[model samples]
Target chain A: MESLQRIDLVGFGSLLAQLQAEGYTLIGPRLEAGTIDYGAIEGPDDLPIGWRDEQSPGRYRTLPRNDRAHFGFNATPASFKTRLHRSEETVLEVQRGEQGELRFVPVIPAVKKQAWIGARSCELAALAIQDRVLKDSADPDPRYAARREGVFIVAVHCGQAGGTCFCTSMNAGPKAEGGFDLALTEILDGPEHHFVVETGSDAGAALLERIPHSQPTAADLRRAADAIEHARATMGRHLDTDGLKTALYAQAQHPGWEEVADRCLACGNCTAACPTCFCSSYEDQVELDGANARRTRHWDSCFNADFTHLAGGPVRASTPARYRQWLTHKLASWHDQFGTSGCVGCGRCITWCPVGIDITAEASRIRQANGEPPK
Target chain B: MPPTGTERPRLAVWKFASCDGCQLTLLDCEDELLALTDRVEIAYFPEASSRMLDGPYDLSLVEGSITTAEEAERIQDVRRQSKQLITIGACASAGGIQALRNFADIESFKRTVYAQPDTIESLATSTPIASQVPVDFELRGCPINKSQLLYVLNQALFGQRPTLPTHSLCGECKRAGVTCVMVAGGTPCLGPVTQAGCGALCPRHNRGCYGCFGPSETANTQALSPHLERLGMDPPALVRIYRTFNAAAPQFQAESQAHERD
Candidate 1:
């Protein structure tokens, strides 16, 4: 049995100084380009402190919180996956010499140990899903695996949930679960700033020991529990995941698919922003010398009608079909392949989607039509 | 004598007259890419390699539609050189977006999308490769799915038939647990006739289908005609859908012609 360890939260400035001195490339949420995005930070001043986010079906905006707190709300537009798993990379590059000897090699960059400071529960769930798909899968992604192995996550509990959030339904969060080195809950106890930190790994314990900190009292544990409970009660969104895969599969003859085709431009913004979508397209290039060759990989979306074209014609040429493929894979068959739901309930797809298509609402509509009770 | 690993089959990727999106699907297999290359020799991919091996190659994966007098002739040569030939995108299996020319006057189309119409020398209709050659298998999409593409490639190399769905996109939607957007929200959709390849995407994103995949087995466009009309789709709009990417396809062509007569 692992014994519970003591961790004291110092002043924001002091905490930042401690991590900085320990050679951690501290990354946290920062307001950039008028949107909440992730960036490398040196201090609490750079964090989106006292900032809260309000997201509707298809809209997102930032607001000021009553108290100056580091993790006042939920997820942002940028997922932690983007920083870890790149959208596109040159996996291999080949150049031909005059001798015409075809020398082929892979393109892998030197990796670095990264410390992520303000990760949320949903984001951690997304990272774990990515790990299963990109690293643990039979065909492991070497580049993603290399970088993922060196990551040390510091999770922050969500005190307020966003409108698009359904992590509670996804069983992913509202509270920081496992898969983190350290979990932090910000508590306001008069003028004295306090954070309840729980060490989850050896790396976390070592880091905690290095900082000047006293053991947390019973009050600290209660404060942490209260924060999580408050966030759960304040959740702004809900999704019905019960029998979700079967509901989608049974609606093959349902008339809803075509209606979406009329409005959807198949722009593929949802897949791009989604943390778990891993489909990609490949390209091959010839060297200037015309002797050697290499291949490149980039993200691909099934939303595009042309994604499945062939020599004589495309098998699925209609926009409705393409749309159907993307949706089914995300919600239904993804379980068959990955043993988990493709969507993490982060709601980034809803917020980033230009057309403002709400997935949870769509799923609910299907259940209603089938005369099933809403989840 | 036992078979050696060196005797394993070779795979080739070819391109025709469309954007390189389909061929790009092969390159996108980053995680398994290095291992895939080790298993098979990339015999002849003009887009991926300049090192071309003279046919007869084991398997040929072709992308794009048949357009221009030269391409019509080149497709025949490709069929002859390969043991097994598979087509990968809308342009290759159906005529593609360029096939919209089948609805309008060809001379007018050449003048609209091109800077120098005279410089463009193409057939009056953009046709799929199967219209000219014998394709062993056909994978459908505007750009084919990477997993399906990989599946087909693996099957061909091992002398097995790939199990791809021939059902409509509606089947996929049902499996995904998405609500019927058309029935519930009164949104127009094309899932009834469109083939299943892409997992249902538009409806999941809270939108309707646009038929990137061509018609499925025994599609009844006539039955859909009234539903589209009730949804306020005009004759021209209905005709436009049939004539866009896979216009030259027999079923879609016949459907569009009927709309024009009406």
Candidate 2:
């Protein structure tokens, strides 16, 4: 068992500087245009202090929390995957040299030793899933492997849940379980703004050895546990994952797909915002000179008409077919391929989808349509 | 015209009855235009040069809709003269913003816009070049995206089809990391049905997309119009949004016509 330590709000600011001193660039949740997104942070001041976000299906708005507590929001539209697996990557540049020789220049992305602060457990779980798919797999992406190798994580135990959040259902969040270097459970008692911090790795322990901290009391520890417990108990959404993969596989002809197709704009927002959707497509762009070209890989969605393009035409021609492919692949087929379900229950797909096509509700609808009891 | 010893593919830019913005897009490719000229000769562009080489051009870029009877006949001659005719913008692909006149009385429009209605030898409806003649390809955008126009040109040189994704602009907005204005702020957007071009211009500026890039391959405006209505768009506003740039596009035209009836 790991011992917990208490650090005041002032000490939190110093912790960021200490991480910087330790040669890890700090990336934390910072407010951008009323949304909290991960960005470069110099100290605790860069964090979204005293502001919280209200998120529901198809809606998200930031509100004043009526208190001065940092890291108040939950469930950003994007996650660490956005930074790690970029939207567009240039694999290499093919140069036409003098004397008719062709030179291939590989684009090795510049990797930085980064200390990511204020990561939620759902985001961490997403990283782990992406690790299985992109890093540890037989065909590991060298780009993802390089970027993932030099990163420090600071996980935050969730005290509040977004209206679309169902991390409890996915067994992916509401508390920092294990996949973090250091975990912070923010305590906002009357006149006491402090964090109950726990070191998960030796790096975290060494960093804590330098920062000012005190042994936590039993109440502080309970407060940390109770905060996450409250979030878990009052989760805004829920899904019964038991027999889910089998049921989803059996639901190939479910009428729920037609129902979703009626409202699905096929805009590909849910897949693009989804942290686990790893589909990509490549296009060769020729320079105006026509002598030089670059093969660019960009994030593509299954919802795209061109995603399943074959010799004659698209394999999944209809919107219903595309929607079915995305949902089933995310839940059922991913388990077969990666030994785990693709969804981390971050609820970004629900909140960011322009039409609010909630996956949890859709899953239940599909199951219930086939005479499965509602969980 | 006398045949020159140089055998560069002859490129022609033709304008009909619309704004010269699409033709200007080619001009805006100033340095790129210079490089493109190296591969293809600018045989007949009255806007770029006074040189007016006639007939049997290798590639013809038509820039406007057929709003006049003369242009309606002239486009066929252009199609006959060119080996490959590519429609450049919303004007030539769809009938463009000027096609809004198609919904109203052409007589009234003539009387309103011009002092002498009889002198204006215009057709009753503004129509795309495709309605008059066969086009090899139609680039759907208001003033076509510079890179896409260049992409089409590069592909045409190699005798390959330009494989531009005919997906919605929502994908572009998402890939660009732009927040969904429709979802987040309840702003009515046409991005769900609009094609991916203009690099998601309107949404990145924090406003709703106006569907200037026109409809995607599978544009479901019937479904999206209702959601836009839920976001406080009245029937006329819904029709107006779709009927803007690509007003005559069959998909958007159908949706707007339906809303107009409602």
Candidate 3:
């Protein structure tokens, strides 16, 4: 059995160096453009140390935590998927030869080995959902599979919760349950600041050997658990998932849909912020000379009129229909399609929505309209 | 391919009352512009090339709006000479920011801007090409996206229908995985009722949609107005919101008019 170890702040930096030496690009949360966005990190200094985020519907602000903690923020609008699955990619390039024969060339992405640090449990859950949708499907997405291959995940158990977070309601966070090579719990007890690290794989155990760390004490374990317990208790939102899919599916004519649609700009901000939304469209481009053509795939949304554009016109011409399709697919139909809910309850969609449309609140309303008791 | 000596399909570009931002987008397609020259002949484009050619052109991409009486007559002539007419950008598709004159008194505008109002001969209302003459296609955007422009050109050349989105901005946001700025931050966005184009630019930057692409198909401005009101927007603010770049568009025009005090 693997044992939990205690690592100091300095030791964490060393681990980052070790990952770099192993030819892994270290990606973690860093303050950029006034928000904590994930990007390449060299060491602990590159992280958003002593910084925290305040998130509410349509509001995101960064503030100084006045602490030495590196991962003080609960979640960032940028998710791991941005690194795993690119926003735009060329799938194929076509050129006509002198003989009039068309030559097609496939565009493949360059290989990049990446290690993600400070991933929260909800993000991990989202990654798992993406794996099933993009990797474990009948026709696996080569682009996603290529980028996702050999990714080293270092998960952080929540010590704090954001104002828009609802991972506890989704049963996906407050603790690093699985899908990580190493799970870290930051324990801040008085003046003592340390981390309890548990290895989930042989590669994680092997990497831990390179860092200066000691076996965790019984008291260290208790503190780690307590920190996660506090995060769960302090979650800002809750979503009752009991018969949620059925309630949503049944409430097609719910008055709340019209109310929500009336407020919806149909701008597609929610799906863009959602970690699990994976719809895309193909764009065909031809050279000015019309000699060569290329087809590129870019992220697309269901809220787009072109998304449902048929020979005659758009099927869901109304904003209400488009909003209905998005909410239903996200909270209800996603279960039928992926055997799981699309939302991990990270609350990114809620936080990033310009109009401050809370999905949890909408779901509760829908459930209530379907004769289901609210939480 | 046609013989080297065979005349290529003639192309022309026209402008009226606009900032020429959409025309700049054509030039902005640096790499694609070189490739585009091989497919279509640049018969006339004052912004790009001074080399002018008489019309009866195969395709004419029109930008801006009909703001003056002379411009209205010129557009009819351009429409008569061109086989296919495609309106590009907010100015051609809607009335653009200049269409703000449609609501207020044009006589006051002429007097305020010009030293002598009698010297200026302008139309009472700024109007889109489709309103003046039949337009084959209308590309929406403050400055129409280069990729969509290319798609329209390619489809037009190949005798195929263009696949432009008439859906709401919400579709782009969903596909891009952008967070809902309205729900999370309580920011008032016009994304739901607005047309999809500009790739959801404002919302991606953690801002609200400004309705640059105008109203989408079946835009529910009636439904969205109350919601904006509930979010603390007063009547005057709502009027201003709908009277932006696409103020002359029927859906937004009616909505703004409904909120107008006088």
Candidate 4:
């Protein structure tokens, strides 16, 4: 029995218009190049209102739902990190001065205010993880921090889980939890003809004030509760997160890794698609005059044969070695450094991987071989 | 050559046969680059610095594998000049992707890959730096971790033992709370035997590991081999895993040899 406000359909449109008037670039989900991706939104019409995503290993397809369920999906292939941490950033530039004193300039990325529409619970949790690694630290990443602070989030509750989603097992989930400013559950069966909006932040409350809406009735709340309940019940994917780290670590000597390494080509497609993977390498470039030195940062993957070249040679010379570093760090050592699990259980790595390697199945094999319960 | 009364440690970066990814790690330290420069004199690094000073350097970071006779000779000379020489990537520490040539006929591989085989001058097999000259330390990875690189350099500069993880990448993954890609997702990964580095990136992304950090200390490859077979991996495929970048490493080499029986 909590007090809630409901904005009429017209009021919601005007609020979005008001946001545009305020010079905020409103971006939401749009069918672009055959994918339901987050992009520029003119209004609600631009969103994939009747479309839902079907995600699985080596597959991502959008299908029309029976009813217009806006937030019917668990997670999308696209994560917010792609825009925040760009693929390439020029770190250095070298130029000769008039006096011939070599000058090197390090370039920092320009920050922007991004308003994200239809973000999910798991993605919100993921953003928190990014904050801890990139911005929450004592030496925060200025560029990432600026973008993070300026961005606004409009989270949508998942009414259905994708085939590859295991957010529930990861303790991240169907329900829109904390971290999002505004949480909305789109219920198509309701006669109220609107979204159930819950304010989770001051920004959300302020935005609510601008939208024309009235207080929600008891029936609307009941319907919202039912939609969430239905989503929780019909989850398509499940994972055992109980003692997962220990089960895998205990079998550290297990030969299953070599088996996996056999099929893996060390292409690094998984790391590229992952929402949380954030390892990077830097580069230096000199201007044509060779007087100034510039440094740049780019995404680096451990699977590459040169990721760890030293004066004498590389330490991990085998693909098995590189693969081990990736898995072990993610499951075991990340806790030591970051104090939380690095994986949010998004299965993008499985779908986008050219070889279609399933992470959960491999972990289970190792666990079973070691006479351990599936965790 | 003696230092010009400078107390700061002189650092040198060298490459043999590589893709230049490993040497790039040093330059990749964007936030720490300026600070690190203040601590050490970058005496030599042809790829990054235009000023290539004569060696007799304090510390030298070498990347790539010894794939030629000339490189073999150069490493020995480098060993003579540097006080501490650390091999950074898989190529230097083991043999690297080029080491794949080890399994095949060296002459045939050269002929197949290069249009003009005579233009390519290579050793019979790609080999690690340790096989050529004495190495003070070896940093494990396909490309060494920047954090680890920074740590090793700091330790060398301060004359302290660099505290690097000798455990498998599986150990790091467990600590990170990353779901086991192999266990949770049934994605084949190589965390058990592979060295700890790369911060368990593949699994964080929900994919199995393709070992790039080489083998860990006390890697029980024999035990893991049978399990891989149980998981439906054939011996040839398993051998390919062992024969990757770190194929020449004793641990991986022996494992690959065991699979050759099939």
Candidate 5:
């Protein structure tokens, strides 16, 4: 039984200030162009307060919330992964020497000590998933590793679930398990509004000691549990993980893929929105001077037609094959490779998909079509 | 791979029926243009240079579409003369805005737009350089990307291969942290079917992509039309978007033509 402490609204501001004092660039949910996505922020004021996000298949919009809760929003398109695993960056720069000898210089980006505030539990799980995908690989991504160094996390337990969320079924959210400096649950009970904070690490305890906080009351504990419970109960989506990887593998030749392919745009939107996807492609840019060149690695997706391009042409020419590759790799092959499912069940893939391609629904449909009974 | 000797490879820039924007994209390279010229000899570029150097060129960048019969014949000779021929921009790769004449009666267009129809002599339809002869590579875009032009030139000069993505512009938008206007704002966007390389210019600025770079490798504009309708895009607007700079592109052309019958 973990005892939780209560931090008042003003104390939340100081917590942000203390993080800044400790040399961390704050990043969290922000309102930008009719949607709330993650980006750099100054402090608690920059948080998307008094706003809730509406997410459905192929649609997303931010609406005003009645209460001043920063973490009321759902999964955003831009995650902590977006900042850590960069889209495109010059990995190596080659300079032509005076004698025509090439000098290959590696470009290691200057990483900022960032405190990602108001991170959802699903996003935190995504960070851990990416650690295995990018860092634990044979050819580890140093760029991602560099950007992720010495970063602090302020996990926000979801008090509200979006229409497309399936974190409860994925067992990734509503309540954060681990891998956070501190975990916070926003409890809004009548006139009382405060964050029930739980220290997850020694660093969290150190920061909490410096901030204004009081021992949580019995009512506060009940409300905090109730808040997380509300999210779990309202979840409108689910992914049955019982034999999911095996079922996805067995449904490789299923016609459901082709049926979905008719609608699949192969735009790589799902891959972009998915926080756990780690596929990438490299582009070599030769300098105009013909003196030096640069090699850049950018995020790539299996959805791209040319993703499987070989010497002759693309191996997976049809949209069905590409979609299958992505789905299978994310759910099935991912387990064989990483020992865990690639999806964190944040539902950004469903919400951000231009045509609303639901991954879990597709998986369920394909499994059933292949004669696999629903769990 | 610097040519056989210390001599720099000869580079030729040709135009057929374009705004010369693609040629200017090379000149627009400015500092990079100087660097490129330093590496390769600019044998003939009527836009920048008056000096005309004859055949057997190492690399040739062909711009615009083959509209006139003379251009149709000339591209064949140019193909024979040059070791490598790379098409630059929509006109050379797909047929440019002039290709709109393809969907309509050219004779009627000539009479309506031009007074002396007999004086003008062109093929019934404006065709790309690839339609005339085999193209080594194609650098996509309406006006073409300067970085890609330089990259293609670098590849041709160094005897290397160019790797240009034919992926959707949605990837570019995602990379830059730009939300999907189609999904988030319900704004009809062609980013899903359009090829990348414009660095997601329009979507980054909070507007829809007009698909100036043409179609992606797996473009499904057929499936996209229904969603565009859901976003409040009318039939004509839907037909019009696909019939833009890259109209002659098979996928967009099929969608635009399909909607035309509807």
Candidate 6:
């Protein structure tokens, strides 16, 4: 069992400085262009304090809150994966010497030690899914592996659920279950605002000893638990994952697919916003002089007609086929590829999708069409 | 144009009837152009250089649409001289926004736009280069993306087959992780039927896709039309969306014709 400590709201800024002192760049959710995006932060002020986000299928708006709580929102569209696996990266560069000798240089990405603060429970679950896909496999990606090393995670428990969120149904969130260096539950009910911090690892415990904190009483611990419970209860959406894989596979040609296809623009927004979806394409660029060239890899989406392009033509040639491929792969075939489902129920797909297509609703409709009980 | 001392592949740029936006994309590759010049010789490009060289060129990048009788014959000669010909931008691939005249009376358009219609000497229809001669490849976009143009040039130089995505604009939107303007804001978007390129620009700015890159490989505009209808778009509005840039594309043209108000 790890130890728990109570840290006041002001002390959180010091913790960020201490992480910087230890040579880790702090990344957290900050307001940008009317939305909260994950970016670099220097102190507690950089966090989205006293700001709450209202999210729905196809809509997201931020509102001001009465209290000055640093993690007031549920989740940001930006995920932790952006830091580990960049959107675009140069993999190789080739140059020719004076003697006409060709020199090829592998562009190894410089690894940076990072500390991710204000991570939600679902976001942590998404990171774990990426770890299984990028690492702990037969062929681990060296770029992702290098960037993932020596990273610290500071998870914050959700006190309220967004309209699009369904983490509880996915059994992935509302509280930090594991996979975090430290977990914090903000207690804002009393006259003074404080956080009930719990260390999850030896490194976290050692860091906790360096910070100024007090022993949390029994009431403080209860309040932290109650906050998490309240969040889980208030979730606006639910998805029944019991036999979801088998159910989706059985309904490959279900009528529900065509209905969703009508609304689904095949825009690939859901997959791009999804934290676990890892598809990419390669580009070979030659310099103007034509003596040298560089190869780069960037994020790609399965929704693309060219994603499954062949010498003859595209494999999935219809909007329904493309939409079906994305949904089935995410909820069904992903289990076969990786030992887990691709979704962490973060609701980014719902919030970011231009047409406001809800994955949970679509899945439930498919389930009912396949003779399964209503969710 | 024959290869010079370095024996580098000779590249030529041709323009017919366009906004000159696509040709400017090549010049916009400032960093890559300096390096590309080292590998490939710019034999003839009126937009970038005054130096004109006689062909048979190794590779030809043709922009714009065939809107005149002279250009219709000239493109055939360009095809015969170039070893590999790749059409760039919507004008070269799908006849471009000027193809909107195909739906209206061309004679009236000429009389309205030009002071003397008899001296205009324009074809009734603006057609893509591929309609007249065989094109090796077609890069789709209102103005072709610089990175994609560089990739195609590199592939041609190395004698490797160039791979360009024929996917919908949805893929770019997803990869960018931009919130969907259509779904959330009820904005009518052509991203589902449009080809992937332009990096989902309109959606990033909280607007809908205008189908500037032409139709995707397997565009189901029929299905997407109903969704637009549900978003309160009528038949005339639907026709307007499909009849923008790349209006002469068969998929978009057929869909627009289907939704014609009259």
Leading candidate by DockQ:
5
Full-model lDDT for every candidate: 0.73, 0.87, 0.84, 0.73, 0.87, 0.85
Off by over 4 Å in 4: A1-3, A103-106, A109-111, A190-193, A291-293, B1-262
Of all native A–B interface contacts, model 6 reproduces a fraction of 0.51
Writing each residue's lDDT as its tens digit, candidate 4 over B151-254 gives 78876766766746555665456444454555334455667678777999887877766778888754667766665665567999898877777888888889
Off by over 4 Å in 5: A1-3, A373-375, B1-6
- Which regions of candidate 3 deviate over 4 angstroms? B1-5, B19-21, B24-34, B46-51, B111-116, B145-148, B164-211, B216-244
Model 3 root-mean-square deviation: 3.2
The residue-by-residue lDDT of candidate 2 on B222-246, one tens digit each, is: 8899889999999999889989989
lDDT by residue for model 4 over A194-228, one digit each (tens)?
A: 77788888977888888777777787788778877
The list of candidate 2 runs beyond 4 A from truth reads B1-5
Give me the runs in candidate 6 sitting further than 4 Å from their true place. A95-104, A288-290, A310-317, B1-8, B27-43, B46-53, B173-193, B199-208, B218-241, B255-262
Q: State in Å the error of residue A212, model 1.
A: 2.0
TM-score for every candidate vs. truth? 0.60, 0.97, 0.90, 0.60, 0.97, 0.91
Model 3: per-residue lDDT, tens digit, A189-209?
779898999898888889999
Question: Cα RMSD (Å) per model?
Answer: 11.2, 2.3, 3.2, 10.3, 1.7, 3.1
**Model 3 / residue A5 / CA error / Å:** 1.3
lDDT at B52, model 4 = 94
Q: Lowest summed-lDDT stretch of 10 residues in model 4 chain B?
A: B175-184
TM-score (chain B) for model 2? 0.95
Computed on C-alphas against the true complex, the DockQ of each candidate is 0.03, 0.56, 0.47, 0.03, 0.76, 0.42
The residue pairs in collision within model 5 are none
lDDT of 5 by residue, A1-375 (tens): 454789999989999999999999888888989988888888888888999889899999888988888788888877778888888889999999889899999998777799988888899889999987787778778888888886899999999899999998878997998889998999897789999999888999899999999988889999999999999998868888889888888877888989999999999989988889878888887766667789998899988866778988788878999999988887788889888878888998899889999988899898887677677
For candidate 2, the TM-score of chain A alone relative to the native chain A: 0.97
**What value does the lDDT take at residue B229 in candidate 3?**
82
Candidate 5: residue A171 lDDT (0-100)? 80
